[model samples]
Target: MPNITVQLLAGRDINQRRAFVKDVTDSAVLTLGARRGDVRIVFEEITPDTVANGGVLASEDDSRAEVVSRFVPQASS
Candidate 1:
């Protein structure tokens, strides 16, 4: 059995996560000869406030603004 863990800031939709897991599972099956049932994948979501770069919190990091925008809630019109 192969176990995989992925960590990223939250905000991705179900479709994106589903596709990612499918592709990873396919690769494990093909490269490691692992059965579908034996493959495990875990996703860990961290918030911007919990992470920092260059001693600056991600939530306040100007350099990460573009990437962080993806996780920000969209305003309804």
Candidate 2:
């Protein structure tokens, strides 16, 4: 059995995530000789504030924050 855990910023659509999971499982099944049922994929979504880069909070870094913010939908005023 293969257990894969992916941690990423919380912004992707449900369909995107599902497709990624399916692709990963299919690759494992073909390349690793693992059964579809034995391949496991887990996704962990976190906010930019919860992640950091180069010892600085992601929210505090303009460049990093911009990248993460792009994935998040803009809120209506």
Candidate 3:
């Protein structure tokens, strides 16, 4: 069995996760010979404020503003 853990900032849509999971799972099956049914994938979402890069918090880093802004929950249609 192959266990995979993905960590990313919160607010990603289901479609993004679905596509990523399928692609990664396919690669795992082909490279690791892991059974599709036996592969386990877990997602650990973190807030921008909880992560840092180059000693600056992601949420507060000016250079990352655009990227972090995507995690903001959008209003419904």
Candidate 4:
């Protein structure tokens, strides 16, 4: 059995996870010779407040604003 762990900031939808799981399962099945039933994938979602990169918190990373906007809830003006 092949177990995989994927971690990312929260807010991605079920459709995104579905596609990701499908592709990863396919790769494991083809490259690792793992059976479809034996491939395990786990997703761990981290909130922006809890994740940081280059000493900058994800919630406050200006350089990542565009990508972060997709996940962060936007308040109506």
Candidate 5:
């Protein structure tokens, strides 16, 4: 049995996760000699507000403006 963990920003839809997990599992089964039924995968979704880079929260980081914007709704001008 093999345990795999993945962490990413929360926002991607379930379809993306499913596709990723399927590919990862297939690769593990083929390359790691792991049984398809015995491979365990875990996903940890983190909110932008909970992460920081360069001492600035991702929710407030200017460098992440474009990436963060994808998960947040913009104000009407």
Candidate 6:
């Protein structure tokens, strides 16, 4: 059995999470010789305010803006 844990900022769609879990399970089955039923994946979603970098909350840190930008889709102008 293989267990995997992933943590990310909140707001990802449920479909996206499901796809991630499926992909991880498939990888474990192929690369680790684990059965799909024996592979477990857990996702933890946290708010930006709960994460801190450089002693500053992610919600308040300007430096983290670029990093977070990658995870969030850009809105049309």
Judging by lDDT against the true structure, name the best candidate.
Answer: 1
What TM-score would you give candidate 2 relative to the actual structure?
0.84
Report the C-alpha lDDT of model 5 over 24-76, residue by residue, as the tens digit.
Answer: 99999999999999989998887778899889998888899898778655558
Q: How far is 64's C-alpha from truth in model 5 (Å)?
A: 1.2
Span of 10 residues, lowest total lDDT, candidate 3: 68-77
Q: Mark the 10 consecutive residues where model 2 has the least summed lDDT.
A: 66-75
* After superposition, candidate 2 runs with Cα above 4 Å error: 73-77
Model 4 gets an lDDT of 0.90
What tens digits encode model 6's per-residue C-alpha lDDT throughout 20-73? 898889899999999999998888887667789888988778887876666654
Which candidate order results from sorting by TM-score in descending order? 4, 3, 1, 2, 5, 6
State the lDDT of candidate 2 residue by residue for 1-77, as single tens digits: 99999998888999999899999999999999999999989988887778888998877788785777777654578
Order of quality (lDDT): 1, 4, 3, 5, 2, 6
Q: Which residue pairs clash in candidate 3?
A: none
Could you give candidate 1's per-residue lDDT for residues 1-77 as a string of tens digits? 99999988899899999999999999999999999999999999988888999999988998998998888653478
TM-score-better candidate, 4 vs 6: 4
Winner on TM-score (3 vs 5) = 3
Tens digits of lDDT, candidate 4, 3-77: 999998788999999999999999999999999999999999887778999999987888988887898676588
CA lDDT of every candidate: 0.91, 0.86, 0.89, 0.90, 0.87, 0.83
Error of 3 at 10 (Å): 0.4
lDDT of 2 at 42: 90
**Candidate with better lDDT, 1 vs 4:** 1
Model 4 segments beyond 4 Å from truth? Answer: 74-77
